[model samples]
Each structure stands twice: as C-alpha cells, then as structure tokens.
Target: MMMSRCDAEEDPSQTKKRKLCPSSGLPEEMVLSCLARVSRSEQASLSLVSKRHRSLLTTPELYKFRTLLGCTENLIHLCLHIPPDPNPRWFTLSLKPLDRRLVPVRSYFYQPLDAASMVAHGCGIYVMGGRIGGRASSSVMFLDCRFHTWSTLPSMGVPRYSAASGVVDGKIYILGGWADIVV
Candidate 1:
C-alpha cells in the first residue's frame, strides 16, 4: 500500500519515522506571541529558527522586557567606547530614586595617566588617588551632589588603578590595586 503525503515517513536505512508539517499550513501568530512571553535567552534561541521568526522574536515589544521589569535600573556603571580604541570608556551611573536618568559621574579618559577608584554613597561620590602621565597624583576629587561641585580632598595612601572601593558607616574603604612608583 502507498502512504499519503501527510503520513509519517521513514528513511530506507532507518526504522524511525519522521513527521512533517502539513502542506500549505502556516504557523499561527499566536505561537509567536506565546514565544515572545518567554525569557530573553529563549527568545534569542527562537530567533535563530528563521528570518521571520528572528524578526518577530526581537521586536520592541519583546526586547523591552528588561526595561519594563526595572532590571535596567540596577546597573550601576556603564562602560562605553568611542571606537578605534581597544579599551572601553567607563562611566558610573546614578540609580538613586531621586535621579531617574543615568548620570555620567566618572570616566577613564585619562587612564594609564590618571586612574580613579570611586565609590558612591548617599548623594556623594568619592574618588581616590590616581596617576597623571606616569607621575603619581596625590589629588583626591570628590563630587558633592548638594553643592554640585568637584573638590579636592586628602590624598590616598597610594596612586593606583583597577582598584576596588566601598562605603561603610559613612567612610570609604579602598582595596587592593597597583600603586605607581614616583621618582
């Protein structure tokens, strides 16, 4: 007996059978809508199925999930690059309830020459020691939101880069980092 086109088909070398989509049939838009409800990772996977599927999966409605869920506000720092450079430009963003827009607090424009270790607490930002053009910098810059000014403070223990910092009980703590030797 001959099998119909819609019937399961098997390869001559294999016993397993495979099913095929009905001819002239189209995937329901509801299916894509359902897929859009999945997580971002899953949506990205669905996009790989086909060009049309990719387009549907990456639509603004689907990609806006992060922003709608308030996840984007948790990001503290953003490293942006202007291109043509191997390193990314870094900027610290303020996510305080009073401040809705991301603020460019600090950057690495003078990196290798001047590097800062910054920590934000309350409404203020603290930046520690850095070097300028291979010379150790003893300057400490602080940003006062209330005053909206950058002021110099007491210098740090050492001039460094790639350092970590945190605030505890209104005091800033500086952690491990490379210190430049001044001649």
Candidate 2:
C-alpha cells in the first residue's frame, strides 16, 4: 500500500510520496530477483528491513525464482551433538555479505530428534524415526534447509530408534530400527 490503497492513513501534514516498497522503489518481482541474488547469510538480515520484505523472503517462490534466474548457491549444514547437551545443534556456513562464518539456526520449532536417521533429498533433509524421551518414536520430519524450517511427515508404522535410511532414485528406503512388544 504505497498510498491510500489499504486505508492506512498517513499524516496529512507530510508531503513525502511513498513508492511500492520504502526500502527499494522497485516492483515486487524485481525486488525478489535482487534478494534472490543476495547470499543466504544476508537474507536473514534483509528480512528485518520491512514486513513485506520478510514475508517475501520466506515464501517458497523466492527460492524457485532464484533457481530460474540461476542465482542459487551451495550451502552446507552441520549438525553436532555433545554429551551433557540434551539435543544436537544445527548450523549453516555463511560465506558472504560481510559476515562469513557458521551461523546457528533457530531450531526450536522442530526439536532435534536424537539418533534420528537423516538423508538429503533435493533441498530437503528427511529425519526419520529415532528416540524421543528415551523411547522409540515413529514420527518423521522433513527439514527444508533453504529456510531452516521443518515440517512433520506421516509417522511410521512402528517406532524406531537409530534407524538406517537412505534415498534411492528419488525414493526413500528405511531398513531396521523397529521392534515388537510381547505381552
């Protein structure tokens, strides 16, 4: 809402004109293009620019557009766990935009699954069954490394811990890690 389009009133005494996006006086598509060209590390900082910019950056369309424009880059994710810590931590190597280092991702939304099997497929990392609270879990979660987000997948038929898994020809294969209870 550059003007009075959204009914959001501005000071009548002010005479300055407002463009589409206050940050960049460009169209939405062009803005997205420019943002797509920015390094992954800098994207998070850009999100603080404005609500519109943050929303636009989070959408899947941004990455798709980046791919179409050949502006994508390689990113590495590192996961580490040490004794005395309840869960493992995830980090990504940030190699651009003035600050280049391993940046920590806020993974609270999707708590780490201890001993969970992980396999990389395209832009997603699948976390298969593992122990949750010292008990076997049947839940499956998918992590979109692009945005450091996670989504829950259908739970497995049987709970598993320390499962062995992999991707074969676009299909996932899980072997072992389930047990039967006998009364």
Candidate 3:
C-alpha cells in the first residue's frame, strides 16, 4: 500500500496525550483560582517556579480574580536613605505569610526632588511638595504599585519641601514644611 502526503502525518487526536498540569492535573482555571488566593507579596516566589506559573501569577486576570475573591494584601513601603546617595530609594515590606525584609521596588526620580513628602494610599505612593532644582516646589506625583507607573497629580497650593504627610481616614494631609518667603 502506497502512503499519500496526508497519510504520512499523524492524527492529532491519536498522537496528543493528556497533559497533567503541575497542579495535580487540575485545569488551568482551577489552578489559577488557587494561586490567586496567595498573598501578592509572595507571588514573586511563586512566579519563579516555572514559566507557566510566572505567566499566571503576573496576569491582570489573576489580580482581578484576587480582587473579586477579596484576597488583596496591603504592603508597607519605605524610602531608605543610603549613604553617598542623596536620592532616597523605595522599598516595600511584605505582609501576610509575613515577610519582614524590605524588597526593592521600581521608582522614578527627578534630580533635586529630595525631601519630598511621601504617603501610601489605595495602591499608590503619593510624593508631594518637594524641592525642585534646589528650590521649593508644589509638584505632586504618585506611583501606582499595581502598574508600577508614575503620574502627576494636582500640585499643592503652596510650594513646600521636607513636609510631613500621612493618611488619615483615607485622606492625605500635608503638614508643615519650609516655604519660600517672598521678599
């Protein structure tokens, strides 16, 4: 019997084997649901297990699922002043499954923006009222943790640097700082 071009190719149904996923052979959807329940702080470790896990852990769908399931976790971010570097570096402390160590996070910096007041609220770090080019500035910027991006917000009424800021009842209050005295 002569074999035709189509006959030489194996039937997909016959050659394909059922793939048992790493999650006990459960479907991808179910695995994602279980993984989504993990605290966001620990997702980095999960992401290192495999490429599939990394893809699933970092997807927007998984984050949305976490929100829908009420599994969101809050992280504490701190700006550390390292010697020889005037610009402060941002770090986040993981909570839940609780990690006390600080993990470095990405942030944008503009020269001469030191002494800015920073406060965290609703998945964002607000940096407001700082010195720009060695002069008092009223510029306001926020870093969105979810997207790791920076955006500008309305500037404060007056330029202030080295101010104290904190969140009270979800409201950010900027307290006293050095202000430019006009002649």
Which candidate leads the pack in lDDT? 2
Give the lDDT of residue 2 in candidate 3. Answer: 18
Ranking by TM-score: 2, 3, 1
**lDDT, each prediction:** 0.51, 0.76, 0.73
RMSD of 3: 9.9
Give candidate 1 misplaced runs (Cα > 4 Å).
1-113
Ranking by lDDT: 2, 3, 1
Clashes of each: 0, 0, 0
Q: Which stretches of candidate 2 lie over 4 Å from their true place?
A: 1-26, 82-85, 94-100, 178-183
lDDT of 1 at 68: 52
In order of appearance, the predictions have TM-scores of 0.40, 0.72, 0.60
Clash pairs detected, candidate 3: none
Tens-digit lDDT string for candidate 1 (51-109): 66654543454334444544333325443554687444444445556544444433313
What's the lDDT for candidate 1?
0.51
Candidate 3 structure, TM-score to reference = 0.60
How far off is residue 149 in model 3, in Å?
2.5
lDDT of 2 by residue, 77-173 (tens): 7787867887788877855555558766657477668878888898878888877767888888988987678899998888887778988889998
* 1-183: candidate 3 lDDT, tens digit per residue: 112486587677844453445746665656767887886666666766887887676566677777888887677767788899877777778775646777665454432268888887887788888776778989998887764457888989989999999989889999999998889
